[model samples]
Target: MSEATASPGLPSRLLADPEMVSACAARDFAQIFQLAKRRGGFHPSRIARACELTPSRVGEVMRGKPKITTMDVIERIADGLRIPGHMLGLADRSWERPAVPEQRQPTAVARPVQEDRPVAAGASGDLDEILAVAAGTRVTPTMLRSLQASIEDYWRHDDEHGGEALRPAVIGQLKYVKGILRDTADPAFRHSLHGIAAELARLTGWTYFDARQHSAARGYFTESLRLAREIDDRPFIANVLACLSLQATYQDKAEDAVTLARAAQDSARLDGGTPRLLAMLYMREAFGHASAHDQAATYEAIGEAQHHFGRIAPSDDDPAWLQYFDHTKLTVDTGIALGQLGDATAAEPLIAEALRAEPTANLRGRAFHTFWLARTQLQGLKVELACTTAGQALDLAAIVESPRVVAHLREFRRSLKPYRHTPAAMELVSRITELGS
Candidate 1:
């Protein structure tokens, strides 16, 4: 590799990994020639001659970039000694492909003529009567559930259509539910409402964060905390706090993350013993300490997290939400903290183990682990692999409805720019940018 190929941004580890190098070598040179011909006006014959590959082989390379199985082709091309090889690998390796374009629905144009009309007498009469009757009925869980379901459906639709058309409806439903929850007097109803409110807050916060409207996300999270407090649902409260703490951590606010995690720990402590809650609290604290580069504190937090994990019993009657917290989850967090502490070698095995243990981990959890792995790979200068993993995470995050997942994805993208020219890294960056847009 020449000076140009040895750019500081390239992952240093790329040279050490036989698989990655082989993938580079086996990259299709045909695709590179075609792209060069189309974009740079390089003749295919010339490129083929330079790489010592037949024109037909060059063509095959072009078609194979998307399905290239070996990294050697890419490596050979990257070394700049093989013209056709360089062309093919470079063409498909520029960036990850953008998401498949969403199908657009046709809409009818409105007529220009407009007329204002008064409501009929019966319509006005019924409106007042209906309002009077509706005012007397208490807001029921069934009604709340209906609204919640509607919000969820709209969100799903938004995910498909970029959320433009459904955002207003989702926000409206959330506001209405919040108002109803505020006025309800029943304890059980309030508890259910609190759960609903936390979810809404998380979703709304995610929406705002996706829009880069951090202030709005902060407000929604604040409201979520308030609702969690109202019902005195300590476990749920801790969950909400964990979300907030993660937001701060991704924003590089280590102190804030620490404070929020400690608060969550205190809330969990009030309920006596809950292994899952303790694990969450300690994991969050470890993340904060890792961010701050406080190795001692990070290790201490990890120890606590491990202690909580050890406390879990097969026969314990844990809450439904806590069921996801297991040895895999703990290991994932440990890997994340270790990665942050600059121990990629130690971190990689832990992360791989976690992924294997929970192949179908929840969307948010998967995102967390993927982002951490990407970070670790990047630090070790494994640019292509880092980007690949990040791209996987972006796909997972698109389907996940959690603010915390979105936040982590955003951080992952930010961390990839140093090696943005690497095929995998570039691909990840483009995907995340498009998703945010």
Candidate 2:
């Protein structure tokens, strides 16, 4: 593609070149790195930063000394470079879709995206119809099954779009489910209903957190934990506690964060949760430790997380919430931990890779990670480039109503104070002000 036709904010100067595009499509990272450095005037470090790899790793690839065999890494490189997905043997490119509006509720006509995983097919319709149909009928297993599918639909939508857009719909369904719990006379189905309620509460809490409503998020988390405890769902409790720990970390309450994270780990120590779930807990612990600036403890937690994660197999009976915590997410969390510890050299590439690996449909997540890249860029003294990167994140922030993004960007603006005298910095400040206005 020509520069004129390339996606916005992409490294078009490189990606627009047909030869480079072909190399990316072919997964020839060595050639791509070489050409980008020689012809594109990008340093190996720049390439490493863009690809989220260590300089040594980039050198190994360029020298053909290290095997570039991991599909995850290849996908990250492809994604970071904005290579067309079809060029990389993927079915679709993320940039093809426009930003989804937050207010668009799922309807009867909503169709599921075809993927390898199980999803609710034809689940785009409103739940009011389902409720209307089941008005006089008793709570049947089939009804619960349909509700479960509906819950999955909202979950998928929240992942694709930001929580702000899908919160109302999810809340509506949740309220309906609570009504069922109140009216249903069957004791046998109460546990199942409670399980779904806990899930709904957790999702709601997550959305609130995503939106930066910390108080509400914490309240919902508490409710979810209570419901999970009522059901004796140790795994679910562990997950919710981990979430609380994450919130605490974000809030800068390091001690509380660490305490909650450890509690989560202890709650599931008896194989009550899947290995992947335990790994997630350990990852949160790492985050807490990193936030507290405890380097040794941080790395230890990360190692433990990886240990548990390495034990996961395709047959593991993990929960739905654990689906997004794969190798890619682990890499992202590790980068964030390292970044928090002020190790920009070690953190930059990993953060870059995570940004590339983020799905286009997940605009909110992309925006959040992009902010991190800009933050890292600033720390590395790449002022002009950092502004440009921050600008891209700002564009995304304009489209997504995420309070977390808003908070992060504001903090980024504060970071630019030292560079306020520079033209680029001033211009960026002006743009950010305009964004807020």
Could you say which candidate leads in TM-score?
Answer: 2
Off by over 4 Å in 1: 1-129, 132-137, 144-170, 182-188, 209-212, 314-319, 359-368, 381-384, 387-437
Compared with the true structure, what per-residue lDDT tens digits does model 2 show for residues 361-397? 7777788788888888888999999999999899989
lDDT per residue for candidate 1 within 1-437, as digits (tens), equals 54323332224343334543454455434444444556434454444433333455456556653232223323323432323223334544322346588997675876565569754447877887676467633654346546556656655554443444555665776676677766776544555666676667766765665455668878887877787777666776787787778778878899999999999999877755477679878999999999999999999999999988888654343444466567887888899899989999889889978977875635556666777787788788888777787777777777765555566777778876677677776767777788777
How does each model score on lDDT?
0.66, 0.78
Indicate which candidate wins on lDDT.
Answer: 2
> In lDDT terms, how accurate is model 2?
0.78
Tell me which residue pairs clash in candidate 2. 52-349, 107-124, 107-125, 108-125
The local lDDT score (0 to 100) that residue 304 gets in candidate 2 is 92
* Window of ten residues with lowest summed lDDT in model 2: 1-10
